[model samples]
Target: MKRLGVLLISLSVIACQSEKKTTGQTDSTNAGTTSSSLTYKYDSLQVFSKTTTAIDKGKADTAYAKIVYPIFSNEQLNQLVEKKAIDAAGDVDSEKPKTYKEMAASFVEGFDSVNGEPDMGQPGAWFLDDQTKVLVSQPDYLCLEHSNVSYAGGAHPNSAMVFWNFDPKTLKEITLESLIKEGGLPELNAIAEKIFRKNEKLSPTASLKDSYFFEKDTFSLNRNFTITKEGLKFLYNPYEIKAYAYGSTELLIPFSELKALAKPNTLLSPTP
Candidate 1:
C-alpha cells in the first residue's frame, strides 16, 4: 500500500528552466507540429477501429483518444511557458491557504473520504468511497477524475481510472476511482455536452466526470491512458496507467504517444 501512493504521485513535476533552449528532435509520430522537418501523422481513428459492427460496441478508446491526441500533438510549451501556466500547474507553496504538502494531504483525505477506516477489506469498489481516488480539475482547469479503480474487477474491455498509487505519508492506499465528472454547476453541462456529443453516447461507463473547461482554456492539449485488456499488461501489478487534459480542440493525446511528450522540465514520477 505504501508503494501504491508513490505510483499515483509517481509523475513528479520538475523545476522550471530559466532559459528556453529549443533543442532535440521531435518525433514524427508525435502529432504536434506540421512545419518541422519531421512531421507527425495520425489517420483519424474510426469510432470502431476494433469493431466493424456497432458504434457503442467499441471501447471508449476513440472518445478518449479524440481529446488526448490534440493535447499531446498540439501543445505549444512555449505558449504555456510564456503565459506562465506551467509554473502554475505546480504552483508550490506560493498558493494561498495550504502548502503543497498540505494540499496533497487534503487531496488524499477527500479521496478516501473515509481514511479512518483501516480494517476495510482491500477497501476497494468502483465509484464507491471505499475504492476510488480522483484527479479533480486543477486551479485553473475544469478537469475531474473518477474510477472503478479495478481493471481487475471490470474484467471487461472498457475501464476508466482504476489504478492505485501508494502514499506512505498517509499510511493508506489510494486507488484511482473517486475523481468524477458530476456537474459542478449547471454551466458545467456545456462541458459534459461536448464530451457526450463527441463521445456520441451518454453515460458511457456511469463514472462521474467533472467539467474540464478550466483545463480546456488553460492548456493546449490533454492526455490520458488506461490499461485494460487492450494489449497492455496490468494484472498482478497493483497499478494502472492513464492521463487526461482539457485544452485546444486538436490537442488530444493518447497514452502510448504521451511518453514521448515528456519534456525535461515536465513533472515525472519515480517509475514504479
Candidate 2:
C-alpha cells in the first residue's frame, strides 16, 4: 500500500509540471498574436500612399477626382506621413537603358515649323540684339515675344547640351580649354560655339557667315546658374522687326510687297 501511494504522488507531480509548462507557452503565443488595429491600419495606409498613378493634364475633369481621393482619405487616418516626394520630369522610357540621356528632351515638344513661327505667317523676322538677347517681336506690330529652349542632349560622357535654342545658329568659336581658364561656361558655352561653327561651315549660302555672341546672365528668381550667351544670330524675314547681331541684313517684304515677288494665283493650284 505504501509503495503504490508513493508512485501515485510522483505521477501527480510530473503531470502538474507538464500542465504548467503548456499553460505558459499558450499565454506567450496568445500575447504575441494580440495586436491593436492601429498597427494594421498604419501599414495599410503606407502601402496605399506609395502607389502612384499619374494623370494626363488634359483629362483633369474625368480622372482627377476619382484618382486622388483614395490617397487623401488614407493619409487623414494615420496622418504620420513624414514626407512626400516627386520623381524626375518627362517620360520614363523603358526601351532606353537607364542613363542621364533622359535630360535631352526638347523644351518645345513636337516643333511644327510649318505653323510659321506663331503670328508671323504674313512675313516676320527674328534676330539677336547687340547684347545678343533674343527678341521675337514685330518691329512695329504688337504681340507676345518669348524664348524657349528648343532642344538639349547628352552627346558624350561628361558632355551635355542643357539647351539648344533658335534652330542652332552658327558662329566662330574658341578653344574649350581657353574658355574654361577664363571662368567661362566651359561646358554649355563651348557646345554653343561648336554649333555655330558647324552651322557656318555647312550653310550653302556664304553670305550667312559665322559670328560669335556670348553673355553671362543670372536668370530670374532663384538665379541658380549664371548663363553664358555662347551663340546668337540674326534672321530677317522682313514682315516684322527682329533682334540680331552685327552685319545682320534681311530682305523684308510685307504681304502687299510679297505680292510683287511671285504671283500666288499663277503658281498655286486652286482647290476645287
Candidate 3:
C-alpha cells in the first residue's frame, strides 16, 4: 500500500530560512496462515538562501533545496537510504555530506560564496528538489524510487529518476545480476529491444544511429528498474538514451515473458 502525503509548512527569516515536515504509515498483509507487516515514514528537509545584492535589486540569485526521504525502523537501512538520497540531491563537494541538513546547508553556502561578490551578474536562481517514495514493499524485497529536478542558470531544468531495490531482511542493495540467471542477459535484451521498438513505433530493422544515444546504436537494459505487481518496469531518464526533448522512456516486461530468465525464489518469481 502507499504511504501518506507530506504536510509542507514554510517559515521565513531574514534572507535565509529552513523548515521540516514528516508523515508516516503502516501496512499489513496475510499469506495463508502467516501474516506480515511493514511501517514506513517520510521526512522533508528544506533550505533557502539568496544573495544580498539580488534581494535588494528584486532579482533572484538564490539557492534552494528540498529533500523528502524515508526513515526506516532498521538503522543500517536508514543509513544506506540517507546516503543515497543525499547523493541524489547533488552533493558535489570534495567532502561528502553526512546528513540532509548538511547537504542543504552546503548547497546554499556554495551559492552564497559564489554570488556573494559584488557585480556578479548572476542569471537565475538554483534549486534542487529530490524526493524518495516507496514503490513496492514485500516480505523479501523493498523498492524505493527517487525523483529529482534541479537548475542552475541553465537553458532548462534537469530531471532524473532512479530505483533502489533492497533485501528486506539483510538491508542490502539488490542487483539485477542476482535476479537473473547466468547467461540470460542476451535473451533479456532481445525481449526488451522488441518491446522498445514497438513502444517507439520503429520498424524491426530501423537504425538507431542518429535517432538514439545507445552505444554503437545497440539496445540494452539499464539497472534503473523496479518491481511491480504485473512485471519489471524500467526507466530511462532524460538524455539517458535520447535527447532531452524526447523526455523519459518506460518499458514494462511481464513476469510471464521472463519465466526462463528470472531466478527461482527471488522477487522476480511469479506469485502463486
Candidate 4:
C-alpha cells in the first residue's frame, strides 16, 4: 500500500432514531423471538472523526473518515447489543485492531502516506466515509449494517459492507448454527449454488471450475446473513467467493426454504 500525507480534524453530533415493527399483529407467543411486535430505539455515538491532507507545491490532497455507531437506549436490557458491536469492531482482522473510536482515528490519522512524486501530474488525494445503518430494530433482535468507501491513489476506490446480528433478550450474537439446524448446511449450500448458477447464467450441468470464483470447484455459503420478514439474506463480500471484479454475491433464502431447519421459537418462523 502506497503511503500518502495526512492531517487530522474532528466533528461531533447527536442523533436519535427509533424503529418499531408494527406491520404485523402483536404475538405474545413470540415475545422472546423476533416475531414479537416490539419497539426498539437507540442512541447514536459519533467518535474518532478526522481529516488528513497532503500537499505538493500549490496543490493539496485530503481524506476524511469517521465511525458512527449505535448504543441501545434500553441499557439494562440491551447491554449485550452494545457490547457485541464494540467487541466485533475492535476485533477486526489486523495486526492490531483498534476500538471503534481508535479505529476511526487510525483511519484518518493514517489515511495514506506520501513519500514519492505525484502520479501522472495528479496530486495524491483520497477520502473515505463510513456509517452504520440499523437493518432490523426489534425488541428481541437487532441487526446492523456498516458501509465504507475508501480511495487511495489507485485505478479505482473500493467499498465494503459488513453486517451484525444480535439477540437482545439473550445478549448473544446470532450465528449460522443459531438460525439453522446442524443438518441444514447441506440444504442451504444446495439452494445457494442453484441461485448462484442462475445469477451467473451458467447451465445447470455446468461446472463451477469454469467460473472465476476462488474455489471454482467448490460451492460455499457466506457466513454473513441478515434476518428479515422474507427470510435470511447472505452477503458475500468481494474476494469472499469470487474475484473483486465480479463484485459481491447476495443470496436470499426465503423462510419457506428453511422452515424445516429453522430453530424453534425463533425469528425464522413465518410472519403472518
Which candidate number maximizes lDDT?
3
131-224: candidate 1 lDDT, tens digit per residue: 1212221222111122221111223222333232222222132222221222322332334344444553434444333433333332111123
Q: Assess the local accuracy of residue 237 in candidate 2 as a C-alpha lDDT between 0 and 100.
A: 20
lDDT of candidate 1 at residue 159, scale 0 to 100 = 32
Tens-place lDDT per residue, model 3, 1-272, is: 01111011112232247455554443342111101244556767788774533565676467787888777666677788888988776655556667777666665555665665544344667778888887778788888899989775557888999999987877778998998999998999999999999999999999999889999899989999998887989999999999999999999999998998999998887667
Clashes of each: 57, 10, 0, 8
Rank all candidate structures by their TM-score, best first, as comma-separated numbers: 3, 4, 1, 2
Clashing pairs in 2: 127-243, 128-243, 128-244, 139-241, 170-196, 171-196, 171-211, 214-229, 215-229, 238-252
Off-target runs (Cα >4 Å) in candidate 2 are 1-251, 265-272
TM-score of 1: 0.17
Best first by lDDT, ranked: 3, 4, 1, 2
Q: After superposition, how far is residue 116 of candidate 1 from its true place, in Å?
A: 27
Assess candidate 4 and give its lDDT. Answer: 0.58
Name the candidate that leads on TM-score: 3
- The better-scoring model by lDDT among 2 and 3 is 3
Candidate 1 Cα errors over 4 Å, as ranges:
1-22, 34-77, 81-84, 94-272
lDDT for 54 (candidate 2): 28
Candidate 2 residue-wise lDDT, 1-272, digit = tens: 11333334433343222111112222321222111211111011000111122235632110000000001122332121111100122223333212111111111111112222343222211111100111221211111111211111122111111111211111111122221323334333334334434544633233322232222321111111111222122232211121222322222112232122322332111223
Q: How does each model score on TM-score?
A: 0.17, 0.14, 0.83, 0.69
Candidate 2's TM-score: 0.14
